[model samples]
Target chain A: MNPVELKYNKEHEYAGVNGNIVTFGITNHAQESLGDVVFVELPDEGATVTAGKSYGTVESVKAVSDIMASVSGKVVEVNTQVLDAPDLLNSDPYGEGWLIKVEADDLSPLETMMSADEYEAFVATEEH
Target chain B: MIGTKRTPIYEEHQAAKAKLIDFGGWEMPVQYAGVIAEHHAVRNKAGLFDTSHMGEIDVRGKDALAFVQMLITNDASKLHDGKILYSPMCYPTGGIVDDSLVYRYDTEHFFIVVNASNADKDYAWMLEQAKNFEVTVDNVSDQYVQLALQGPLAETILQRITQVDLSKIIYYTFTHGEVDGVPCLISRTGYTGEDGFEVYCAPEFGRQLWRKILEIGASDGVQPIGLGARDTLRFEARLPLYGNELGAEITPLEAGIGFFVKLDKEDFVGKAALQLQKEQGVPRKLVGLEMVGRGIARSHYPLQKDGEEIGFVTSGSFSPTLNKNIALGLIRSDLAVQGDVLDVMIRDKAVQAKIIPSLFYKRG
Candidate 1:
């Protein structure tokens, strides 16, 4: 099951904030839409990612989609496992598939992120 | 969206919860389950495809052989009864009208299957060309439903339901018979590299046949494949999709299927122009590429050599069978040599790729 306590973005990324460090990955909904993750290209550690900007890309058998950063932060850690085993994104999007760890410049953007219940409703609307 | 066509087995696709997409004006299933899984299923076991959108045209008359010989780039006069020949119908300027398969029922009767998107246009062009010869061209696309049962297990699965001894129907040949009491024409042909059959029957019986085949083959792991895996399967085999590999502007010689072009046997459409173009040499040719960099090279992605644009990818995908990013690109013939290194511009990033032979997969 998805971690219910984590904050979610409309672009289908979930972020877990422990103090100023935010650990984030694409949501289960995103992985479902993009079947069979074959490759994942992530930003290197020490790269600064802006809120509402693309920081990486995920490719499946059929197509590729951009992975967006939900909050302004400097990437402190990159998930090396995902680079070698991309299918982990589909199998464990909330846990071992977590993409990057970033130290946030401000936690204000986290306030604007939706709760798990709100994100579910948002996905329902998007499907329609 | 209002007038897009639907095939006889459209309901079957819906029942499976397939992801539908607009392909050549037909609302066809792109995937059921998923593309990679479906692709592997076809490569390892068996998969069924709803190919009803392909257009069938009947060409018959006293002068049918001569008329067909004049129309296509292949030597149609060589085909005997029950044999099928793949050919490209071209314009006088060496531009393709469509790549089609010609089935010889007799000297006076031949059936041509054209690409779905080019159905109306191909019919119109044939009619316009018919004025110079004595023959009748009938577009019978709406009357038949086509199913492609493909893979290693295809023969065993189909043999259980049909009375027409599958062994007698050699590759590139066909025979008429009944499947589950439904009259049909079964051909040992397929676009996928695997050995398979293309079953053509009455439109009304499509759904029944689809379900029965799936039910019979269910225990053997038979899956109802969609257009997504169909494309990848064919692409892996180096089979060209009309709009992508062969188009109004791309000649068969330039596309690297020149073996089908009979330049010496008969004077067909595009013969004179193709002869001249061949003498001067084709400026561009199709080549296969494998991504050496971390990004996928998608269709229409620009190709560069020494930082200058050379060509663009026609079809590209992550090959499930090969487990690599592969692409077919039309680039300058000079740069088409094997092992040549080039760069594909994916979005704004440049990805390194190496030139390889066009055929990516071959069945053992």
Candidate 2:
């Protein structure tokens, strides 16, 4: 089940807010679809990212997919631990597998993202 | 969607929840459990593959031996009964039509197995060449089904069911055998770099034979491997894939399979052009690369030397057994030497890589 507290993007990324900072990571459905995660390419901290823009790539043994940004801001921090161990994304996508933390320019962008119930409905239709 | 052909074992793949993909116009399984899992199972244990998609053409007539000798780049006169020879069927221009195996059933009968995608083309080419000789070329691909049982424990598991003496069958040799009452032509051959057997049976017996082998080999954890692991297994063995390494524009000499082409023979289709290429040396050669940077160097990725595009990668992946990113690229022959540093363009950035030996993995 998708976490009720987090918001989701159509590209399959989830965002959770803490003060003015928002954490970004791929949804559970996204990681499951990509298969075993072998490699991940992430942007460096302090890099400017625009909403809906591709920031990095996630590679499995079988395929590679681009990771798009959910909300626009400057990357404040990166999860080096997850970068070193990519399987963490497969095991714990929500906790330690969070990709980046961005200091949001404004809080209004989160309002445009889908709620947990809406994202679950979207995922159900996609699975069919 | 274009209609995709299904093999005899398509239902078996679907029953196992395998991820099916379109390969060479055939609806085939790319993976069942996972690519890495299946790859390791084949390397450390035994794995079974449904290779029924491979096309088999039969050449039989009084002049079969002489006719096949003239058609392929390899000498067929040296092949004895029940033996197999690997050769590239080339066009007169030295370009590879397809790389195939010539199974010498007898002096008057031969079975030629070609790639699935090149089946119709190869059959047409064979008929065109047979006009000069007195032999009949028949495309009997749908009449047979093929299965490959590979790994270290392959022989042990197969020995339990087959009546033929498995020990007597040497490498590249085959024998008529019965496995659980099903008759098949069992050949000690495989694409994976391992000790294995390739069994050829009738289409009606495919499902039973597949199930029986998996059931018997279940104790050793023999998984039903898909084409995903099949490609990786063969890639690490330095085997040249059809569309990637060998093609209409690529010759056997440039694909690093010149050893299979016998120019010393009296005459063959591509002899004149191959002889000319040998005298002048091929411009490009296949080489192995180990990624020194982060990204995986995939197929068609350009190789750069001193900021100039030198060649492109043919097959590459993160090797499951080695746990490192590696690739096989066709680069300028002079720069194909080992330890040479080159850049592989992976999208927008060039990743550093070092040239290594093409055979990335081999069993002791």
Candidate 3:
């Protein structure tokens, strides 16, 4: 089971919110779907983000895909470690694999995201 | 939109939680655990693959062998009964039409397996060539399903179900036999560069055979592999794919597959053009590349020398066997040499790469 503290987006990203700042990373399911992560292009610090928009790109061994922003915010910090060790997304997607921390424009977007059970159900439906 | 078709095993792949992707024109399973894991499984143990999406054609009549000989660069007359020959069918311009495996069942009967995406075109090409020969060419792809059991333990697992004495079957040989009472064609050939067998049978019986193999070989660590591992395994072995290493524009000699071309064979299509190219030398050759810096080289990625495009990658992957980025590129014949250094443009960045010989891994 995934940790309850981290909220999941419909796109499979997990964000842990604290006050106005939110730290986000992809979920284990997303990492598994992407295969072995080879490279991560992270958003720059202080960059503005819009909910449901692509903020960065993640490349796997086979193909590249965009990492979608789940909540509107200004990027507070970016994880450089993931650039060097992209496999962290597969090993520890919720912890060390965190891509960025964002200072949110508003926290209301959190309510639109899914809980663990809802996300699990959503994934199940999509698989079928 | 995914414009690929699905095979009979599509539902089975979904049930196994395989990640499906568009391969050629088929919606096939790319991987279940992952490409790396499945690749390792085929290397160390047995891996099962549902290769039903591949095209199978039947040629039978008095002039089957003669007809096939005129269509391919390889000499079909040299193939004995129960023997398989790998050859490239070419156009009149000496460019490859497609690479295929020809199985000679008898003097008058033969089977050919081709790449899925080129099935229709290959069939049409064969029909056009068959007008002069007294042979009937039938595309029987949909009537059959193919299952590949590959690895070091493949023989052991497969021997449990058949009474044909697979141990006596030499490499590139095949036999018609029954597995669990189901009629099947078992061939001792594989693309993973391993000692394995490919089983061909009716679609309904294929599902039963697959399930039976899994049920019995579960203890032996046999897992249903997907196309992800299939590609990586073949890549590591330096096997050529139709679209990547071969196309309507590239000849077998240019792609470094001249071993299958029998120049002395009685006149065949593209023979004159290939003879001319052989005398003058092929313009380009396929070479292997190993990335030096941190970047994955991919298909169509440009190879640069002194700030100019020298070649482009045909196939590339992060080799699970070598644990590094590896690629195959078509470059000028003069520039194709082992240990030579080049640069690959990846996302506007030039990454250092070394020209290595093909087949990054070979089993002892």
Candidate that would win on DockQ: 1
- What DockQ do the predictions score, one after another? 0.73, 0.62, 0.47
lDDT of 2 by residue, B113-142 (tens): 999999999999999989977799999999
Q: Which pairs of residues collide in model 2?
A: none
Per-residue lDDT tens digits for candidate 3, residues B10-100, read: 7778888888888777888888887778889899999999999999999999999889999999988978899999999999999999999
Candidate 2 reaches a DockQ of 0.62
Q: Evaluate model 1: give its TM-score.
A: 0.97
Q: In candidate 1, which residue pairs clash?
A: none
Candidate 3 lDDT by residue in tens digits, A5-44: 8789877888899998998889988998899887787778
Worst 10 residues of 1 chain B by lDDT: B292-301
Cα lDDT over the full model 1: 0.91
- Model 3: per-residue Cα lDDT at residue A55: 87
Tens digit of per-residue lDDT, candidate 1, span B123-226: 99999888887799999999999999999999999999987899899999999999988999999999889999999999999999999999999999999998
> What lDDT is obtained when candidate 3 is compared to the true structure?
0.89
Poorest 10 consecutive residues of model 2 chain B by lDDT? B1-10
